[model samples]
Target chain A: MILAYIGLGNMGYIIAGHIADKLKQDGEPTLLVYNRSNAKVDALIADGKHVQSASIDHIARHADIIFTCMFNDEASKQIIGKDMIGSGQMKHGAIIVEQATIRPDTAEFLASIANEKGLHYLTCPVMGAPPRATAKLLVPLLAGNPAQRKIVRPYLENVIGKVVVEVGDSPGSALRLKLCGNYIIVTMVEMIAEALTLGEASGVGQNKVQELLAGLFAGTPVTDYAQRMTDETYDDVRFSLDGANKDTTYILDLAEKSNADIPMAKVFKNHLDKLTSDYPSLDISGVVGVVREASGLPFNLKKA
Target chain B: MILAYIGLGNMGYIIAGHIADKLKQDGEPTLLVYNRSNAKVDALIADGKHVQSASIDHIARHADIIFTCMFNDEASKQIIGKDMIGSGQMKHGAIIVEQATIRPDTAEFLASIANEKGLHYLTCPVMGAPPRATAKLLVPLLAGNPAQRKIVRPYLENVIGKVVVEVGDSPGSALRLKLCGNYIIVTMVEMIAEALTLGEASGVGQNKVQELLAGLFAGTPVTDYAQRMTDETYDDVRFSLDGANKDTTYILDLAEKSNADIPMAKVFKNHLDKLTSDYPSLDISGVVGVVREASGLPFNLKKA
Candidate 1:
């Protein structure tokens, strides 16, 4: 069996590495890799991993399955439509698993095209940060036809994740799950921002409020992620606020399509949009900065 | 020194009981108790407690300090201003400690009124519900003059709360702190509601998302309070959605007055408003019900 991997950004790279590592330990299944940036491919080759350099033709000729983990819906569409669709070396009976956060409609559209080409398709988005993926501590969600899901379950087990929750038998099911997970993250940031601002306004130090929060509400990700708000640790940020803004924006867009009113999420996105102005490179948790600013207090305090 | 404790709500009753119990043990100071509806007063009197047939005026004339733990600003003002002020029975050097969640402006206004009448006023709101207060687990924030705060510290120690967080000299500071604390609570609900909705949309069972969240981000109030959201447990509600909506609406009024932009909080309030419409009698945590509706799923499915 052969596996073709595409997209080598932060999440994609970690996942692809895990895939290569798994294949190596499990009798060395043939691996084919592709990225617009060839540097990643060179690095993998230098690491003594066998990576097949496949322009669309070679990937179709050699690989029994392809995994795509692109940035968004547009990127996923561009990669497949522009690069892979018309490659003359097409093979039948192959399956494609998409592990990217994209719109449900986009996933359905792509799955339809793949089905028309006589290929099985699965939407298998994941839940984790780059570090979590690297540590194999990610959560995976698989959604597709039963046969396509079973085909990818083996390689999925090879990756180090805490869960592989299989959902509905639909192309967009997994992506839908990922988007929902992101909605939670942004919502957490928004809540912390307002709470901290209220604390400051009340003349109770943020640290003191945080202490009480950590004690009573000790089991929520909302408070566990407090330092990200209190410390104003944004510049050297792990998750960019801009990225979160994009996700929220997309979620809102989807909500609009579904006619689901998510005023709370929209309000949070507006705050994120405002925050991006002053701290353009701010972390998503930098929303607390906006809160502090609106509270008319000093952004940061100096140690006495 | 005499102390008059008024209001016997779930939190109020426990805290007053703690104070009366402590004072009885100490045998130095006298404790008088009062409640609206006047029906519960007999029970306190029957317990050999200094339960009084007293109006706010009666309490004012007899006690060196009067502590009010009523429900809202209007109730507090009606009891303190109309009844207490109209009776004209307050002595010079007498102090009033308020322990209700009200607008900061109300606190400041009441303080101004008390000052004009040569009365020492302090806004000292207590944190914790009935169970916590019964165990003396509440956190108290004291906002007043140092002299007035000093006079009440010993008595406050008996029943107010465990930790006396000293805010500042502003009469409104304690109320501000209380509002801030509730801000955190409502914001948390908003985020949890949205996150759970998103997670369900992704085909990850709300229960699975809860499990993953508990493992990854289960160290704060946001997640701890989210147990209701995860488990879909909302029947025996502790804090009703009406209460949450009331608090959010109150805080938004303050935010608007202060000209602070609480777009995120505004969104949260909208969600709570929506929830309040459906589950009019549902607990605040019952906002999860609204989320379930948004996700097009059934909630509270008990395991067989």
Candidate 2:
């Protein structure tokens, strides 16, 4: 089976590289790769283990199982909807596995569109950032028809994901799970940011708070994000503020449509919106800067 | 040196028990114990390890170092203020080490009163619930004068706490750190509740979300609280709803006083306030029940 990966951004590039590396270990000739920009594709091809597709349609026409990892619902819709990779372009019974964090409804909508065109679609949005993807440690939340899941399970387990959880038969279930996971992460970021800000404002050293978090609140998003905020190195941008804002918006929209009250999402959305407006280039961890400013501390105060 | 423990709520009882156990191991003759009601004191004395003090004043006068782990600032104030364990009651240079979750200002005020009474004071609020306290795994955030911290560090390290973080020399800094840590935990409980609600509402399984949280958000406040939430067993009240609301209020008041824009804290306080009004007897994890109700689910949906 020809395997392809599209949208070679930070997370996607690392994920695709891992998949390519796995396929190469099995003595596969090459994996198909595509991206809007050429640099990532050029870099992958330069490594000499994968072949770059000329366009998304090239990937659609050639690859049996294609993975798309985009930034948001709009990007996913543009790629899988009529605008690009139209239903007729791909081989019949081709599988489109989506790993982008998008609205559950959008995943269902895209799945329906794929079904009408004789293409099998699966939503398998993953948990973890770029580093985990690079290490092939991303956890996949899988949702599709049982048959479709069976066909994709080997690839997910062997090539891409370390752990794959089958959420349900509905394509949207995986996306919902993805949003739930991202909601935890995003909310955790804001929570830790506020925590550090409160600690600093109250004259508790950030190092002490960081140490306590590492000991008590260790092994989760708390320590990871708290470390970033304490270091004030927001420019590294493993997950960009814009990307985090997108996921938060997706979560809020999902909550509204599902009649769920996620008040923290609303608050987080406002904070991200305000922060992104002020510093569009800042990492999502930069939300700490907003909390610091509110506490009458200079944004990104240097630690003594 | 005579050591005393006051307050015997869920957390305090276990913590005081651990200290008594340590004292017994060290061949110390007795530990001074006090509570408003006689039941807990009776129970501790029934264990045949510790001695019960007649009153808070008795503890103040007899014990060289006293640990107070009350529910709130008012209780702490009453215990150490002029009304109860007054300045003239305790021996000179006696130390009052507070472990209650209270406002930073209250800690400072209590410290000042202790100082005026020729006593040394330290705020050493602990993190963790009853189980952790029982296991002697509680993390303590300690702040006081250098000399006082030195006097108390041996007891903290030997008997009560697994990790002790000296936040600063300022007496209020430790309370602020404790509040910050509790803020992370309380907000995490709410965030996990909202995420679970959103996931369940969007047709994702609660078990799936719980599993994902256990794996990705493991070891932090998220997994422990999310497990309690998904189990719908909020009544095992390790931390009561009222107590959580109290901590949330302390965090919000601290944020406001420090000019920190912790919008999440404001939202969480409102949720806890609403939840406590309805299910005053529920566990803090019952904050999940509030989110579940907001999402139109029953307060405690039985897991299949």
Tens digit of per-residue lDDT, candidate 1, span A1-304: 8898988777777788878887888877647888888988778778777566666567767777889887777787877644565453557878878887888888888888877888777888877677678888777888889987887887886475856777778887666666667777777667767766766665556776676566556545555568767776666677876578668877887665544445677767777888888778867777776677777866554321
Residue-wise lDDT of candidate 2 within A20-75, one digit each (tens)?
Answer: 88777777656788888889998888877556555777777878888888877788
Residue A235, candidate 1: how far off, in angstroms? Answer: 2.2
**Model 2 quality (TM-score):** 0.93
Q: Write the per-residue lDDT of candidate 1 for residues B126-197, one digit (tens) a residue.
A: 766565676787788889889999888776674556567777789887777777777777776766666665
lDDT of 2: 0.81
lDDT of 2 at B115: 80
DockQ, per model, reads 0.30, 0.70
Docking model 2 quality class: medium
Provide TM-scores for the models.
0.75, 0.93
Q: What is the lDDT of residue A233 in candidate 1?
A: 61
Least lDDT summed over 10 consecutive residues: which range in candidate 2 chain A? A48-57
